[model samples]
Target: MTLLFAYTSLYGQTLNYDVIRNDKSMGQTVVKRILKGDELTYHLNTKTELRVIFLFDIEYDLKETFKNGKLISGTGFNTLNGSVQKETQMALKEKFYELVIDGIRTEINETNITESVSEIYFEEPHHSKRVFSAYFGRYLNFEKVGERQYSLTSPDGTNVYTYENGICTKVKVTRDFATFEFILKPESLLAVRNKQITGKTND
Candidate 1:
């Protein structure tokens, strides 16, 4: 029966997810959909069109709305090259961030995802979002074991490991009976060479 106000993040990359009551009198908390674009799309707000251009696909004409601890909206078209992938509705809320995925609808509280991450700031060595790096607050670090694998620790001292390319593939957050999780895809680092080499083209 704890009532909480609203929460905001500093940057944007950090995702914020929370739990909320349905009727406020039902005495039952429900998982709500907040922001679909976490720290990756924090720059987007009302009256703004955020464009996410990926190597494989491009997302244009995107819209977002924030209210009542919930985020509801949809994109115009999701195209890989020139075709469309139908229209999909993307909705999430802050309250839902606190509850475990399955824990929300059922009594089971378990899911493999990170929930409610916000107020993130990038330090030195990272300029123009080209490279992503964080302090991890002295609590999170890289642990070496085999060849390409790592273990990431959360703020509450929870450890989640990955064993594919030594990168964080997923993040999970849970409190009381709620858990939220998210999978992260690696960013593209292919530089575009726009230099023209010429040795004096004679007549």
Candidate 2:
């Protein structure tokens, strides 16, 4: 899950994907990134509902701020079945991260950041570590299987991601209890941006 895109200039981009489970559309996830000055901000939002024995719904949101390739602060909110499950805030200290979860304060080392998994997608290649999990959560291990294919393993299960031109084209998650796949839409962020610019100039 390494991204090799050059980011020397400030820009804002958005990626949209369809979340599918058992070949059915379950929800959608939107990831937005904004680069300004020396700071980069990433925001992810996901919403899904499943009608099984009962109506089950979930919503998750994550916001992270990074400076010079290091995480500075982050916030997370998660809801399941229409009830709030967790709310957290985190800030990086000298050698640790101070996390406030549900109003309870705790300190964690940089090795255990909750959003570490997301970093795997944006870091440079040939680094020391290829797999990393959440600071206090699940463990994730990633291995490059092919030119554009990667295998990601976690306590929950295993998943595979295929990327093309620095954009993830497909993701397959398989677990004992559930299996899901995320497919990138044909309309990418770059295409949308170019279309908007073209429309404005023609007007």
Candidate 3:
């Protein structure tokens, strides 16, 4: 539900991923980052469908705008089976930050929110060790594990990110319900070739 990201450039870019579980497609996640003068904005969305006792759908959205190097505001929603599970809105105030989660509001002194989890989808966080979570309204741990790989741990779960050439190639999200894998759309197309190379069966 969270990610770690850093700004590597001022240019804009978009990234797409296929959510997969047990060699089957569950849904997709799309992320975009835009630049306008000294301000930068990012959006992240994920939609998934699965069946346990019954079929259900899940959608998650997050939006944030930053100026210079400080956060201005952010909004997010998590919906499950057509019902909202969580919602939050955060904005910068004159003295501190204000956050409202599910109609309850609070004040935060963590004023400097430059980087967050969304950036991990586009740029490599080579020097970033921690990132703020817009949803959780707190900072989380991010650790570099291997070359082009990193791990993020939070209360919900732990996630692993894999990158190639500074772009995220895949992500493994661990949840209490199940493990979800987000593979870059372009890289996911290699499944067929991989089956042939390894002589494996998806079914």
Candidate that scores best on TM-score? 3
Tens digits of lDDT, candidate 1, 25-124 = 1111111123444423322111111123532322322333334323322222334444554333333443321212212221112121221111011111
TM-score of 1: 0.21
Ranking by lDDT: 3, 2, 1
Candidate 2 per-residue lDDT, tens place, 109-203, comes to: 55434335554333322212353332333335567776656777766578777665455556787878577887766686454434321111100
After TM-score superposition, the amount by which residue 104's alpha carbon in candidate 3 deviates from its true location, in angstroms, is 1.1
Per-residue lDDT, model 2, residue 116, is: 56
Residue-by-residue lDDT tens digits, candidate 3, 44-151: 999999877788899999988889878888999999998999999999998888999999998888767777776666566654467788688787877888777788
Which of 2 and 3 is the better model by TM-score? 3
Clashing pairs in 2: 112-135, 113-135
Every model: Cα RMSD to truth: 20.6, 7.8, 9.0
Candidate 1 error regions (>4 Å)? 1-9, 14-64, 89-203
User: On a 0 to 100 scale, what is the lDDT of residue 141 in model 2?
Assistant: 55
Flag the better candidate by lDDT, 1 or 2. Answer: 2
Against the true structure, candidate 3 has what lDDT? 0.77
Scored by lDDT, model 1 comes in at 0.25
Our tally of clashes for model 2 stands at 2
- What TM-scores do the predictions have? 0.21, 0.75, 0.83
